[model samples]
Target: MDVAEENSEEALLIKQHRKEKKEVQAKIQCMKNSVPKNDKKRRKQMTEDIAKLEAEVEARHKEKLEALAQKPTEPTQVSSITNGVTSLDLGSEEPVQQPRVSKAQKRREKKAAQEKERDDRIAEAEIANLSGARHLESQKLAQILAERELQIRQIPSDGHCMYRAIEHQLNEQGNSLTVANLRSQTADYMQKRAEDFLPFLTNSSTGDMYTQEEFQKYCTDIVNTPAWGGQLEIYATCVWTGGALQFCGTTGHKYREQLVLPDINCHLEDGDL
Candidate 1:
């Protein structure tokens, strides 16, 4: 068999196992979350059930891998006995010539290889996403949210995440204001207190403090464009809204979602949201 055909079944099996494992993990998580902490007996039974499920799945996966590894290749006949003489079959024949592959066939093979490679990468990424480190962080965050009676309100990671999160908080607290309104207010406040903020604002290109023109342009960008907000904007926002803002993360330390935007696309400087 050709390499692609030989490995196709193995790849399919791997994909199937990965999907099954993920589903089983989700089910286990749901079981844990749905059960009350006070129900010790029920929780114990659930844990046992989860252990059994994990063992069964792991055993099945290991068996499959072993089976694939031990699979015997097609056997080739070396000699044939006719009557009393043994005739050795050497590769002497012009080995039935393989049919010439068409350009279309080559293209199809290339496409198939590319697709398989993409699928393999996707599977690897899925596994990486479920690494113990990330899973632990997720569990810790969930526990904290439950303990504090707080739920995460996912903010869009558009360069305006900070503003959107603040806007959400304000709306929840009975303030009716839009992101644009908040942006305008923040810009106006910062402009009024230019002496306070301008010292902190630095030319991103050069490491020097922003000049009067640069500071004015920065405020204009914040008011008109989707520029990312930082400490300066946060200060202005707090002053205008008269509300306290709290940032939380799995780690006690503050964290910001990583952003990747072109310099020309948005004036986004690294900052916590």
Candidate 2:
């Protein structure tokens, strides 16, 4: 179908025609050599006939060549009959492309990568330092608390309807005090625990800022007092608003589902006043 390939076919046909013409010439020469000298006139007449036949052959050859030349050559790039290389001039389907990744773009990418790595390293270092400090501080704090006669205690938190065991301590006399978890315990309950530290606080500000840990210590003192003996005698308990508390001791209902109210702080009762 391609013009170039068709032209090549035409060239081959021309070559084949030329070879046929040569073979015909060789046959005529053989016939002439076979005749005798005495038969000159006959030979001449025969030669004229031979010339006419050659002319007829030549005319036929030329007609065939002209027919081939007149045949329209397809402009298609590929030939269905032949698998041959063909020359061509055709438009490219692809657009001209600019080189990828400009110098400035590369620089930006590299800088961004470096910045990300730097930030990650800094974050990791800060976290490591904080963890180390917390470890040492926790160790020291544990030692200080152990100085008091501490025991584990639990408080019922309905949030976890199934009771949980928490940490705490009973004093020498047998009365116990617990730290509270503010998130789970009621706001009023947190306030009461806050007030428990008040008697030991040197100033109103200290009481206002009383920590769960601080109140816990003072409770231990009050429980151990000779006046209280094995029973805790909390004068009153008051409830206020905010903050967190850690619960202490193993918790379970006094009798599976029954409440266990022990005599302790009465601060909340005073609030009715």
Candidate 3:
């Protein structure tokens, strides 16, 4: 189909998908209100229905993406001379040969093509990841995320998601904070209380305990650079803030929420978080 026709069809599909999603959501809410709180079997069945609807919605979204990806890229058009011969034709003589592309130009073109292919691969992988997550009941997990929107601020993924997330939470509560300052403070706290963190510290990459010197270096990196923070740094930030930090964990199927109270539980790591 032509571009305009394809776009029109895609828009209609998207609108239908949204309408169905809203209807399904309304049904779910109605079911929740009518069903008894202790009716486990009925509730389980309702959950199954919701899951199926969500999966169908996700499938439609994937179909749209695949269709767009497969659409042929249009070639650029150029105007040609009407009389097919003028500039290249000599008056009753042979025409000059066209110039060949140089090796450098060919290399540049190859590099551009490779870069485009790499980007396409990345886009495909991201779509596949989203598709895989759909089967995990991401609709439920998305609800938890929506609930936390009031309290949690999203952090940019500039190699500082952890530190920036913490900083945003603190700043929201009337405290002026920067990720750099938070990182420095956390590193200092960890360094001062090395004895406490040493037992729990291990190099995730090597599966070995971090030596004192190595640990110190790691702390220094956290302080001076934009190294990604982890559970240990989060605990340090909690200590610095003098309050428990509430974290919501979602597994697509279920949520395992936690309150990280200061000094009570120094170690907590949930991949879902």
lDDT of each: 0.66, 0.43, 0.64
Best by lDDT: 1
Q: Which ten-residue region of model 1 has the weakest summed lDDT?
A: 77-86
Write model 1 residue lDDT over 65-84, tens digit each, in one string: 55664565332211111100
Ranking by lDDT: 1, 3, 2
* lDDT of predicted model 3: 0.64
Report how far residue 166 has shifted in candidate 3, in Å. 1.5
Model 3 lowest lDDT segment of ten: 76-85
Candidates in order, TM-scores: namely: 0.44, 0.24, 0.47
Whole-model lDDT, model 2: 0.43
What is the Cα-based TM-score of model 2? 0.24
Candidate achieving the largest TM-score: 3
Ranking by TM-score: 3, 1, 2
Over 1-273, each residue of candidate 3 has an lDDT whose tens digit, in order, gives 366643553445544655555565666566555444454666798788877866775666656545643555332111111111122221223333335658787677566655555566756766786768653555565566778674334444445788777777778798888888888888988888887677677788997889999889989999776677777777788887787888776665677867877774454444423
Candidate 1 off by > 4 Å = 1-139, 252-273
